[model samples]
Target: MTVSVLICDDSNIARKQLKKALPEQWKESALLVNNGEEALEALQMGNFDLLFLDLTMPVMDGFQVLAAIKEQGIQVKTIVVSADLQIEARNKVAADGAIDFIRKPVSASALLDVLNTHGLL
Candidate 1:
């Protein structure tokens, strides 16, 4: 089965790094967005299977995106990839339905482990 993927971050560098960290097959195909609003828009139309999101952004933030996903019952699996490592942020994302929270500058090994742990790969 094809696993559609989305990566959302305000920084161009972050987006490129995330794209690289994704499973090789998905790296070139994953959709990249600059913020939460764009992510949601793409998700609604793309029927994406996975989302790698950022917490701090100039446009809509990841928390708002997560809330909207829960409110609208969006079916995508979200994994928050951010520099926000506060315990509160972690707990909040979990309660909001994110399968996992990955710290920023995400390594390929960590991303792989999380995806593997959840059987996304």
Candidate 2:
């Protein structure tokens, strides 16, 4: 089955880069959103299997999105990708239900590791 994926980030370049980096099959049906609100809306409207979330955003940050997901019991597995490389941030997101936390300027190796660990690749 094709895993439904959502990419939520404030940076257009980051979105484009991630889109480009994704395997063709995965990219074929992926959804991209600019911020957490849109991500939540998409989740409500779509059956996404995975979420790539950025922590910092203008309207509804990723932390809020995570909280909403937990409260609403959204089924998608989330992986936080942000420049916030703080250990506290990682611990908080993990405790909040993120399957994994990835730092920003995501390298192909790191992304591949996440995909592999989650059996998404």
Candidate 3:
């Protein structure tokens, strides 16, 4: 099965980096968004297998996005990818129902590991 992913990050560079790092097999199935608001909009528009979300953003933040998703009962799984590696950040995101947490500047192997762990590969 092809896994559809929504990537939310404020940095264009970060988005490009993620796009470049994702396995080529998943390229065509990925959707990139610039902020939490856009991510939420995309989620409401289509069915996605997973979400790669950044913690800090302008219009909205990852925490707010996750909370909104949970509040709306959206069922897509999410992996938090952020530069902030604070224990409290992880705990909060986890409490908000993120499936996993990945540090920023993520490597291809790390991304793959997450996908594999979630059985999305």
Q: How close is every model to the real structure, measured as TM-score? A: 0.96, 0.95, 0.96
- By summed lDDT, the worst window of 10 consecutive residues in model 1 runs over 20-29
Question: In candidate 2, which residue ranges exceed 4 Å CA deviation?
Answer: none
Per-residue accuracy of model 3 over 1-121 as CA lDDT, tens digit each: 6778889999998887887778887788899999999999999999998899999999999999999999999889999999999999999999999999999898889988988898888
Candidate 1 Cα outliers beyond 4 Å, as residue runs: none
Greater TM-score among 1 and 2 belongs to 1
Report lDDT per candidate.
0.91, 0.91, 0.91
User: In model 3, which residue pairs have backbone atoms overlapping below 3 Å?
Assistant: none
TM-score of 3: 0.96
Against the true structure, what is every candidate's RMSD?
0.9, 1.0, 0.9
